[model samples]
Target: MQPDNSQPKTKPKIASSTTDPVDFDHAIGPDTSTPDGRREIRRATAASAMGNMTEWFDYGVYAVAVTYISFHFFPTEGGTLMALGTFALSFLVRPIGGLVWGPLGDKLGRKHVLALTIVMMSLSTFLIGVLPTFEQVGILAPVLLVLLRMVQGFSTGGEYGGAATFMAEYAPDKKRGFLGSFLEFGTLGGFALGTAVMLLLQVGLGDEAMMAWGWRVPFMLALPMGLIGWYLRNKLEDTPVFQELEERGEVQQHSSLASLIRGYWRPMLVMSGLVIALNVVNYTLLSYMPTYLEGQLELDPQASLMVILIGEVAMMAVIPFAGSLSDKVGRKPLWIGSLVGLFVLALPLFWLMGRSFPLAILGFAILGLLYIPQLATITATFPAMFPSHVRFAGFAVTYNVATAIFGGTAAIVNEGVIDASGFLLFPAVYMMAACLIGLLATRYMPETAGASLRGTAVPDAHDTGILADADA
Candidate 1:
């Protein structure tokens, strides 16, 4: 089926009771026709991206600093595995966070929930920098770390879905793919920043100082980032789509679990499957690659960091282009291509990564580039899977549940399987399996690239003609 790139010709009736006027001529939301309107959209994008960056910065720091974290928090015998386990443990609470925060976001507006979640997430990350080591507090240190990680995870449950929803709602429909890509751009930016900081400190401070105190510096930086995100978010009003919902009194009073399940089980399941592919590749490459390279491939820590940094920066550079391409093409095509590419190349790349340092860089770069299409289109694709009223709830609940189960546990799973069976290529095989699920999900996903997300009905439901088949 051909994609519709045109905006809807007729405007929805703007409620006369609204305090703020909405320009409905544009069809998506907000008036992009005026300079001021464009500026507001930019502001909204920045607000969304900043919060997203702050959330991911913590994950990136934690992923790269596993060695230090394990050293400071766990027993020496199997400290790395324990640290990874703690990382996985944080994700266990993500669904709980989603359950609480998602409905609140849908009911309360995006900005307030985002402001609270950012502060909570950032504070939790910052406190980790100050926590006493296992040497200082013994078992209590790991316990404390676990507590803080859970808080971060909980807050993030709301942060990501809300941020993406905000960004997607504010963006023009035709440019949604391009603009939404910036959110993931923030994601890669956060990972790159954290990795860069660790690399710089490692080179400047050396091993002794790094292990002693330098590691804390990256965690400490999170507070300021969070504060900046909060400030930006507060500067803007809620998203135009959300504002319209409020004005129309069409907003859901409560996005209850039973309601969401009964209404949106299909999208939730499809999103879950897509996320399995998205985040398994995500955590495996961005989060676990350093550990895998250093421990499995025997690359030095510095080299491992460099490889990931280069690959991430490359992905960041291409993300905008890929997102723009999705606008011209469609989200499903890119996703299908990426899933297929990864499935086909996962094992060979893993094999090549084991051969040498230069080959490792080549292998990782290829995998990262292949993964970019999926990453770049996340904010564009996922949020539009449901209508605006339940967008936040649908995205948060589905995404967090999937991520908690599969995405967050990726590192630990790979490590545990490798250790138990002595199979070094298990991560690659795991990614391939995830890609298969993504392919099936993509088959049933509605093509929403240029669809309006304004009303109560599912966006592009009639255009794609897949939901009925999916239900069947």
Candidate 2:
């Protein structure tokens, strides 16, 4: 069923108190069936997407080029672990970034916070390109590198949540899933672009040059990409959802954290559980798979990157279709089915990937496809889990905390596990465990398909006149 767009006959009862039995029937709805709305959607998507692209590109280059980075920054002994450890260290501060930026986004507006984060993240990434190596600077090289990574982690905590919230608020209700997929598309596309560039540089410059100077090019490129994202975002108005709350003098009556803890804890926990599964699969495939293939499976480095590139492109192409499909069938069914499929296929797929290059590509492609349901629906589903007043904070804090724990550490944990036990299939087992936890949490979430973002969490509470209750 399509979402209701008609205005309510009367001003709807606002939820003034955390305990108030208020409805969100008329809280906020989609903008534009007109040319202007479509134009704004395009503009909003580009602005949000550009920064996200840069973020993932940095991640891709770092993950794909971990060996070179390790050799340059850290000492020869334990350097690979240190390099990957630095990679993981960046994630440790994500929750701090979330805490600092989330409420500010709620109070000051999403666009400005977005603008600030992009600049910070871009600068940090760009500077990494110029930092002196251990041979030149001794112990200071890795220290500076770790500091920059901390800044990158801090900025990104706010970036992902704000981008998702901004896009979801701008999107049409019935089409939210379809439109929101663009964010993740940018995510995959950015990673693919980064990987492609690294591959080209390696082929063109040879291993020595690539390790010495060529690897820096992708990090340097972040500056221009960030500038583009900033310009696009600066031109746009805040979302109508946020704008309305601002105009009504209710934008931030209390801190987003306070409001979230007082009233929105349930959705926050459920969303975090879902994030654990999403990020584990996401980080494993996009950021850690190349390492796995080369270090453990003994595939050629270039060949592993090629398989990842192919899988990323394949996944990027399918995200929108998955998002659109969820609009018709609902979020829970697709999520449930996808988790089940992953649980059943993960170990076998990991085994298949070890057999041959062609088999690895096919294995990664199938896993990427299975991941689409969650990725495509995230922006559409997670934002709706909280009210506009605390949506950014709720999503940011919970999502980042979960990612910090499960997603960021996935590579390190899998590597450690395999190193200790010599089990090549450890990542599959880890992912399977995450999938089980996710399925249990997903079972209790409201279906939320075609459900109004303005509606209250209570089932069948129709005061908003915008939604009707649906099953999970």
Candidate 3:
């Protein structure tokens, strides 16, 4: 059924303490309708996006440098699989991190939790650069890498949910889609920066040097990038919606997980379904593409990197426009279009990719652009699924759980299935399956574009007037 967007006659009643009532309007941050308010919103966007960029830079570097990682850390036989497995291993602990940090962000505030998570993520990423190789430490080398990856995963569990919530709450109701896209802009920026850095080093230092130590340089840069993100985040205040919750004593003081499962299970399940598609496509295109191109398709390492780099840049360029478009036309339509498009084209594009070098770039670029609608609207769509109180935990727990199951393991799953069946189109088939799941979820997803996120009530398209038509 299409969402009913008519506004209700009265505001929903929020549970609040009578003795300590706070003015809701006053609790919200600077007036976003004003120029000064808009400036502050932009700053908040940058701070949130920077932390995200810092986090993904690590993943990007790790993904592109998997060959070196396998060589240095694992045995000759099944080394690539081991590296991919380690990559998946980090995701195993993300749910635990979410369980711990998500509720804390609800109780403690988004900024505090985000600050701590970024530091942990960056430090662990930096430490990977300094870890001893298998030749140096025998069995302990891979062990250390695995441990740090877990730390990165644990920290990331909190980082993304908090950042998205932070960006969403700070943005004006009308412009949330446009502003939120910048956070993902930072996402592709990080991946592009990391890929570009790795490529440059591979070219300048030669393959021998890159294998020896050049890969470490990209990991090391994560520290300073993290520090800058920390600085930017520290300069800002918590989201206005969160502040309003705090002022009214609505912030969850105890375990939010139990409450989340009991009260908001429907949205949690829906979000999880959406995430399955989102991250499968996400990890496949951004994280696993280089490996698939190089290992499965028999493309050269440099050529694979070039393909990924070009595709990512193209996606980055289109992301903001897609995000802005979501505001006018609504998020569900863009998502539906994207899922359907990818489902239809995944096979053809993957086939085209095998034809030649230029075709590979063209195929990847087309797939990436098809993916932009979903990628661009992530921050705008997911956080609005729950109210301010459980938004962090709701998003963190479900997203991490689904991501751990399907996303983090995407590379290994694709590689294993193809290795077993000798089916070259397995990845495309896998992505098509995920897109089907996403389409089902998107059908039921509430349209929240231009909807106010100020209250504890779940934002719904039915509760507010339609901002625009499908053609708008």
Which of the numbered candidates is closest to the native, going by highest lDDT? 1
Cα-lDDT of candidate 2: 0.83
What lDDT, from 0 to 1, does candidate 1 have?
Answer: 0.89
Clashes of each: 0, 1, 2
Error of 1 at 43 (Å): 1.4
TM-score of each: 0.93, 0.92, 0.95
TM-score of 2: 0.92
lDDT of each: 0.89, 0.83, 0.88
Which pairs, if any, clash in model 1?
Answer: none
Candidate 3 deviant stretches above 4 angstroms: 1-27, 466-472
Give the winner by TM-score.
3
Per-residue lDDT of model 1, residues 1-472, tens digit only: 2322253333233222323433334454557889888898888888888889988999999999999998898868989999999989889899999999999998999989999999999999999999999899899999999999999989989999999999999898778889999999999999999999999999999999999999999999999999999999999988878988887887778558998998788989999999999999999999999999999888999999999999999999999999998877778889999999999999999999999999999999999999999999999899998888889999999999999999999999999999999999999999999999999999888788776677676777344333333334
Cα lDDT of model 3 by residue, 324-433, tens digit: 99988889999999999999999999999988889999999999999999989999999998888778998899999999999999999998888899998888999999
TM-score of 3: 0.95
Arrange candidates by lDDT, descending. Answer: 1, 3, 2
